[model samples]
Target: MADLDAFLRDLAAESADLEALVADLPPQDWTRPTPAEGWTIAHQIGHLTWTDEVATLAAADARTGGTTFADLLTEAAPRVTTFVDEAAAEAAGAPAPELLRRWRHGRTELADTLRAVPGDAKVPWFGPPMRPGSMATARLMETWAHGQDVADALGVHRVPTDRLRSIAHIGVRTRDFAYTVRGLPVPGEEFRVELRAPSGELWTWGPADASEQVTGPVLDFCLLVTQRRHPDDLTLRATGESAAQWLNIAQAFAGPPGAGRKPGRAG
Candidate 1:
């Protein structure tokens, strides 16, 4: 696991980078359709902001001694889903500046809270009680993933950095999230992942002797796992059945299976 302080800093930086890209968009662009079906840029950002609030509540619940982390997620799932729906509806026609302000404010609060939380503090997630560090990393993964959709829709590109370590961590650990989503037993074997970061450095995880391997550029791998970019659209190369199959349903963040966009639809 990554050092908690470093991970939180990376998460905060990535969120700021993503927000900067959309903060000055024209009002028309805010309403432009994204690769996500029936969702615009506003919807994507609103979803991120909404979930940040949920994280806050989950963290609070964990500290107060009310419910198990799993139970907290189970109870809050429907409410968060509904909140995202209502937020998207409300922001559908809001001005670009107002939408940007709201996103920034929400994300700022989330980052601050994440940094303040102790590393070992457990927080409610879809499956287990994640440490504060792990949860912060998960949030970073979501921001980067959704930011990809917004960037793709706007014809911009994000040069992902080594900070992607946080995302890579979640992607590897959440292999079970993929299995659970498909109603399958979690694979017993680990797989090796070898990726080239945007800065051209290599990042690897899992046992080297494992029968599976996922290799590719860091950004492409992130995009693929997040379901923001289809694996077929990127340079990801999976060797072995388990690795390939895992790639098909990889999701680092918490949530039900997203209605993943089809290949070539966004391009």
Candidate 2:
């Protein structure tokens, strides 16, 4: 496993990168449709902020042993929905500068909260309870995925980094999420992933002798798992039937099953 501190730092960095991208968009741009059906850039950012707030509450609940983490999330869902909807509506008529300002505030709050939590602290998540470190990684996955949607709406490309580790962690750990969403049994065999990082180093996870292989640049792997880009959009290659199939439906974030948007749709 990667160092917990390093993982949290990466998550914060990615969140900062995303904030910079949306900092100066035009007012209308915030309302422009994203690849996510019926969601705008504001909606996406709002979703991130909403979830982070829920995470903070869950973390607090875990610390107190007030209730099971699962129960906390169940209670948080309705609140999350209301927050996103209200935030989206509030941002709908705001000017670009105000919208960006609000977004920056929310992002900073989330990032700061994550940093303040102890590494070993467990929190309620969509899946099983996760340590603060893993939860931070999961937040990174969400930011990158939604950041891609925002970039696509503006006809921009984001050159992601070696953050494939976070995406891969979500990919493998959320295997049951994929299976449950598709109404299939989770496969027993692990899949090996070899991706070239932005720093020109190779990052490998899972056993080398695993039955399935997913090899490509780290950016593509991240994009694929996030459902930001189609598998064919990059040079990702899968060697086994299970690997190939997983690639087609990979999703790192929690929610409903993502059938994956078409390639051109993101552009």
- The estimated TM-scores of all candidates read 0.86, 0.84
Give the poorly placed runs of model 1, Cα more than 4 Å off.
64-83, 91-93
Decoy 1 TM-score against native: 0.86
| lDDT (Cα, tens digit) per residue for candidate 2, span 1-267 | 246668767877887888888887766778888887778888877766666666666666656655654675566577864545665555555666665566566656655565565655677666677786777788778878888888888788777677767777677667667877888877789888888888988888889999898998888887787777777787899999988888888877777776676766554
The per-prediction CA RMSD against the true structure, in angstroms, equals: 3.0, 3.3
lDDT of each: 0.76, 0.74
Q: How well does candidate 1 score on lDDT at residue 210?
A: 77
lDDT of 1 by residue, 24-116 (tens): 777777887888777888888877776777777667665665464457556656887665567666765667677667767776676666556
Q: Relative to the unseen true structure, what is the C-alpha lDDT of residue 138 in candidate 1, on a scale of 0 to 100?
A: 84
Model 2: CA > 4 A from native? 1-4, 66-102, 115-120, 265-267
